[model samples]
Target: MIGMGSSRTQRPHTDRRDWDNLKSVLPFLLDFRSRAIFALSCLVLSKVATVGVPVMLKGIVDALEHKPEQVVVLPIALLLGYGLLRLLSAAFNELRDVVFARVRYRAMRRLSLRVLEHLHTQSLRFHLERKIGAISRDLERGTRSVSSLMNFMTFSIIPIMVEFLLVGIILLKEYPPIFALITFGTIAVYVWFTLRMADWRMDDRHTMNTLDSQANNQAIDSLVNYETVKYFNNEHLELARYDKTLNEWEGYAVKSQTSMSLLNFGQSAIIAVGVTIIMWVAANDVLQGQMSLGSLVMVNAFMLQLFIPLNSLGMIYRSLKYTLADMDTVFRLLDQQPEIQDLPHAPALKVAKGEIRFEQVEFGYQADRQILHGLTLTIPAGKTVAVVGQSGAGKSTLARLLYRFYDVTGGAIFIDGQDIRAVTQESLRRAIGIVPQDTVLFNETLRFNLQYGKPDATQADLEQAARMAHIAEFIAKLPDGWDTVVGERGLKLSGGEKQRVAIARAILKQPPILIFDEATSSLDSTTERAIQRTLEEVAGDHTTLIIAHRLSTIVNADQIVVLDAGRVVEQGTHPALLALKGHYAALWELQQREEQH
Candidate 1:
């Protein structure tokens, strides 16, 4: 709870700069520029025919008025012709929708993939500092908004603009100055009001979205710790807290909806008034012999057609505002440069003999607080080395350094005489396999989980690795065997089962070097003994480094390194370190006392 900052406490404020951010998403659309332009062109043609249909009906009416007897075939023919044109327009419209949908889906797929790739390249610290739920929510909302934005822009906004322009042109040809002035003036007023309402609602939508993310984060957190909540009988308290956040979210949502409703009502009223005034003027012109009744009918039809697109204009603007808000977070995430990035001309790591040497390495999570200070160590190939230390003694940090999770602040780490800093991260990571204390597994089948380390691993190889980890027998006893779903984060499996799965995955990877960060810390004594035997068998085949807290666990290690307060105080063979009466000896004595008790 120390770093917990309530998102609800951060009040949302709209910046006019959101429009600029929204414009930034346009480049993604521009990637398929040719297709987008073609789609828009087709949409325009369809809209023109759509607007023209009403005018054609006016022509039919006028033709009926003039002939009244001899034009039956011609009227029927014209009606059929108009119907065919409308059908063609509808087809074109459908085609445009299909093309744009493909374009939007492709763009979203590429963007999401890019974001994921970027995240994968980022350092462990970057992920540790952020909440998983928040990141997930941002990505999900951003993708959905971008897709909806593409639809709104093509199918709604652009088509509406074209319809408005066409209506103005038609009116200008018929009544010149009078029609142009009325049409342009109405549009200007409508746009002004739409922008105003959109500006007001933008902040509310942002607030609502922030609350949504918080609610999701809280829900995920509670669900993950459901057992703890039940054990403590705090389910009611958790529900109340969730309900409070939901109520806050509802408040902002209601405000946004109410504002939108008012905007819609105001827009409708303006459109009604504008159409009434235009009709009244046209009616006067017809009576005064300045315009024919047919012309007046055409103008009325065009007016009705214009309002169809105009009504959607407000909704489009509102959606555009929300899209901008969504992009703000997406761009913010995309713009973040990783704290640790590869060197421009980094080389691949040469094949290593599992010899690791850390020379005067200094490191810290923050600038003001250092963790490891001038620490130096070496582990030779094909040896089982144990790092024994109390918590926060930088034992885990040292293991992370071995994997290049964070570069040393000063000095260097070398693997097989090659500086880790000069080596490509991919190659370096591929050479090392780590089994973390808290094993994380995907919600997938056991086979998939086992093959995660080596995607192309054969079934025989998988079974062999599982057997070595002592998990094959347990897996066979399961209802679905290797095909059983592990559930989220391997929650379906016991801690010992999950640890064995992690070990099995690492074993299948067959890296030159292996790291075990208290791998058996979560297991019972019986399971630990089984895993210890497996570790001994694996040690003969690979260079293994382990962080051990239980003294008995490391008694057979080739070398035992004792650390205290981020510095190595004693290191030798287990028997030698125990005989030295140093820090290792003292810790061993304490552990033995606890075991006896």
Candidate 2:
């Protein structure tokens, strides 16, 4: 079995936690390396153009201060270059975004696919424990956060640093070292303060995310149970729950904004102080004829340009932190190892006789409670075996084990004298067909759901299967016929209708082994009897396991197995067991009395 465990990510991104996420994203970047490189090149070019803007303005100011008679055509050229520089900055940024679009979309697509694939492989317990609304909300947020984090780091954070470096170098060459020291020190302090404050705000952000997900989950849960809410008159209770979550979220929202206020005020104070010191030095230089007024204008312009990005420093950092938290959830889902997997070099299951045997099968979903205890049973080839049991007697569990949904905890299950664990799960499952008690159909047309069993079934095959399942007469009466839509979970159809659809689906599969897991439980006596007849025809010479509650449904079974607790107490033909007057006979008598009453 190959289990790809949790990876923090491939390469390190913003921090250590981002390593796993970025590692997963590295391949997408490498796949489009040329475009990434071109985009990066544009980033540098754009920053260069941006840094030159202040210099050109300085030149224009110097020329304006000089006599018009003494000025030459140089100032006019400088003005045009200044305009051109602004245009190039905007143009290069837009072009870079255009070039990198493919990389962004491809990365999101691959990661989303990987997440989805892994979620499908997870055990049923994992899905049962989590709400669908919350799970979907986290995944959606995580995928979107990937794009945001990348955009912020590349465009906002990285480009701003590059511009600051260029401005610092220019200021140093043009003035005394004290001016550069003041600007750099102020920036360093501003960054440190913003990071510390943003780190604290992360708790509030996390709380907000939790409350937001709860609110969404509650709202969706209530909506999905719309009929139940209306029947119980619980609309006020649902609204009260939803209102509570929002109110808590609102409290955190206020705290988040308040903290942001403090950060902004502190950052602005630092920048104002630095700019004032620089202006003071520049005015002294101008008075002493050591610096021109235009030089002072250029220095102030650099400060203004640099302050723009710093203003959002806390917000950007906080957003990136939250994004990584969301992505961590996705990565955690991707990292989960499926409990059951096909062994290495496992071959496809080859069914020569389709005989199924459970040898001392002991199993449970949890270790503390056992569902099946030393259960031994077998269905011979070309025969029907009925497993009759009361509620929680391991009837459904036997069906699940036969399907290999969960491996036996203490023993092995075999099909055709071959251990199921030794064969590929895909092939093992492919060789068996099951029509579960609850039939969940896609929200699609009848034709689509029918053909889902055999994707390439011919029109004649579809009609034949539908007729055999006793659903053809009903479909033909509908105006849309096969094209008629089945609502979500097939809720639009009656219970009997859904069961027939499931039976038709199984019939089309043409597997060597069939499991009818309370397949007719949802139908009325008349419809159930009709479906049972169709099932008998489909069973043919293949192995069949019928897990039924009503003894009447399995009276004709070749062999009947009576289960109590976790063990099979009796096994034989229904008549043979009745003659023996054992547990099977007693149960049969009880059912007869109930029916008479």
Candidate 3:
């Protein structure tokens, strides 16, 4: 398991023109382009209808002013026509929302599944080195940002551009140079300020997000180890620590919100000034008979229509900045390459009889420290072999080598005349089954856990494996029997029961090679005695390797190898080693003395 060490301070950096990152998600959208294109077409039509509203108003005003006595019904009908168009536009906008939501949800699902698949192919060491909580949070944040990006692209960017073009065309056609020049100039200024504000705000938001992740991770870490807090009476201390993290998060959050408020307020003031000046100039034109009253009304309405889309653009810009920041974290995780990877053309393993051999194997987790040094061992097919060692003697590391969890730095390990490293890891592992010292079980039913090794196993097969592992009787006594939900991490089951479940899973696998890494350490003496009988019965039909701390557990082994400081010190039958009176003999003597007391 990876330790959550002191939190590292992350510097906030926003990518300029991260609109390119939007391209990374384009393929997903392209896959559903037919739907997306239809949605965008509706969006464009909605904007056209929205723009036509002000034009209709201008027409009604002109018709009523010029021919008030002729007929009032015509102008009234024009007003109702514009109202219907607005209603239709609103309906299309709502429909567009539905389409965008489907795209967002589908993209999120695809990305999350890809991340899961990549994680599955990674080596065990990668998982051991990473914080699971942090990785999960990163992926979640990325998916949400991608969804937001899709929403903005469809609803904000496209509609805003369409609105801008319509307003420009209307201004040029009605009130030539002045209206067009002022509108374009004001838009330029708005874009500049929006971009500047977005740059600063994105930086602040990134900091806030980092702080939030840290605070969340700290709280989860504390909760997961609640027992430690209670035992140490450090609940108050942990609470204070969490409170500090929360305060830091609040500090950044406040800064971000304050900046956003200032930007919005400044932009609103600018828009108010520009709109006031343009209307004032139009009113002067109307007085001089250069422009009609209806045209003035139309110019004012068009400006307001343009501002609506521009305002939406501001919100989209902000969202885009946040989406980019989130994507940065996610991309970094996806880019991480596992230290161990499969070789091209790696052949599948086929072992008829499990004959294992280690030829001068040397290994280490790091360059400076060697855990196994030139270790050599051999176990003939269908033999029961035992490895006895003190803590840190590299006994378990040897078993890991057999499964190619980490390739040996020197020499080789072979099973049935084939080098383990030369075969595909999947094939190599499938031929062997391991029952680790610390059994892990999901929060699932007894039947589900048992079937994990053999998903297609029948009820009869499950029961047979359970009986062999001495867990069927205990499982039957549960309230819901095989349907009983094992609480998180099998916390609902006792240590012995958990181990028996693990054993049953391994038994169901029925691999040709079996490894027990202190398998009975969690069980009571009676439970161990019963499991020992099961082990003996199974050993006759398979090649078994046992790493034992208890000398009595492996006393009947065909051969026992005693290791000290990463090197084998003795190899012989248990009785023969006792007679040799070496390190193994000394260990046996110590066990006898301790048991007598």
Candidate 4:
């Protein structure tokens, strides 16, 4: 049997943990290689044109400083060049964004799809333990973060670095060493301060995220269980729970905002000092005739150009870091390994006879709490076997194991003498149909939920299944008929209605093997008897396993298996087991007494 032991937990994201997560996003970005190349080309050309704008401005200033008669003629060409350079820079930047839009948005789409597919592949145990609201929040943040990180990296961070390099080259080549020293020094200090402050402020952001997720989870949980909340009159309790999280989040949010103001002040101060000193030196040089007025103008223009992006540096850095943290959550989700997987080179399950055998199977949701213990049973080809047991006897687990929702921990399960673990899970599942005890329908039209069983089923086939399941008439009475919307988890429908819908869906599947897990438990006695007859008709010539609570429903089964504490205590024909005066008989007597009253 396949091993049913796999465990993992999500770790908090840190700088050290985020590198791999960032690297994981590279493939998505690289998928559109031509677009990436074109976008990057635009980035380079834009910055080059941007740098030339300040140089053109310097030329305009110098040209106008010439003899008054020649000033008008000389400066016109320079002024036009300046404007052209500015326009080219803006055009190139906009073009870059237009070309890269596909890459950025498609990356988000592909990554979102990847995360969703991965979530589906995860084990039932994983999903059962997860909170839907928190997971959805992470998914939303993570997918958006892909675009955010790329935007900051491509448009904000990279452009700033390119501009800095150009400015540094100009300062070093055309001016004295001190000019380069003060400019570079100020930048280094500014970056260092921003990094340190942002790093400290990360705690605030992380706290806020945690509290936000908690608040969101609580609200969704309460809403999902709205009936329970109302029944208990606990509206204020839910509000208090949500408010507790929001209050904590607000504290961190205030701290974050206030800290941001401080960081901005510090950054501005450093830039101000650097600019003031540069202007002081430039003005002194022009007065001493060591530098022209145009040189001072060029210096001031370069500072303005450089400082604009530099001013946004802190915000960009924090946003990029936040995005990486979000992406780490998504990548960690991807890192989860499914507990159940088909063996190497596993073949499709060929259900020629559809005989199912559970041989000494031992299983549990947890190691310490065994749910099924060495239970052995069988349903022969084209026969029906009904398993009856009290709660916690592992009846539902049989369906889970057979469907490979969780692999058996010990021994093996086989169909047609072929080990289930040795075949592809998709093929194994395709050969079987099940109607679970609890039926959950999508919040969509009744037709959508019914057609889910057989997407390509004909309209006639659909109506036939619904009629057979005894739900067609009920649906026909509705104003919207098949188009009627089923609310969340089919809450709009009565329990019996939902069960009938499930039966119809399973009937439409028409698989060789069928499992009815308390399929008629929700119906009244009259509807139960009617649906039971329909089920019997549908089960003809198909291997069927019925897990039932009511003893009356399965009296006609070919064999009855009595389970107590996950062990098969007895197995025989229904009448034979009733006559045996064993556990099955005792349980039958008790249920009959309850029914009579």
Assess each prediction's global lDDT (C-alpha) against the native: 0.84, 0.85, 0.85, 0.90
**Poorly placed runs, candidate 4 (over 4 Å):** 1-16
Structural similarity to truth (TM-score) of each candidate:
0.95, 0.93, 0.95, 0.97
Q: Which has the higher TM-score value, candidate number 2 or candidate number 4? A: 4
Instruction: Between candidates 3 and 4, name the one with more favorable TM-score.
Output: 4
The best-first sequence of candidates by lDDT reads 4, 2, 3, 1
Model 3, residue 94: distance off in Å is: 2.8
Candidates 2 and 4 compared: the better one by lDDT is 4
lDDT of 2 at 191: 85
Alpha carbon deviation, residue 232, candidate 3 (Å):
1.8
Pairs of residues clashing in candidate 4 = none
TM-score of 1: 0.95
* Candidate 3 residue pairs in clash (backbone atoms < 3 Å): none
| Tens-digit lDDT string for candidate 4 (1-597) | 101232222224455467787788789887998998899889989999999988888887777785567776778887888888889999999999999999999999999999999998888988888888899999999999999988998899999999999999999999999888988998999999999999988867876776777678888888998998899898997887777668878978898999999999999999999999999999999999988888899999999999888999999999988887778778888888888877889999999999999999999899999998898998999999999989999999999999999999999999999999999999999999999999999999999999999999988999999999999999999999999999998999999999999999999999999999999999999999999999999899799999999999999999999999999999999889988999999999999999889
Minimal lDDT window, size 10, model 4 = 1-10
* Residue 269, candidate 1: C-alpha displacement in angstroms: 2.2
Single out the weakest 10-residue window by summed lDDT for candidate 2. 1-10
Highest TM-score: give the candidate number: 4
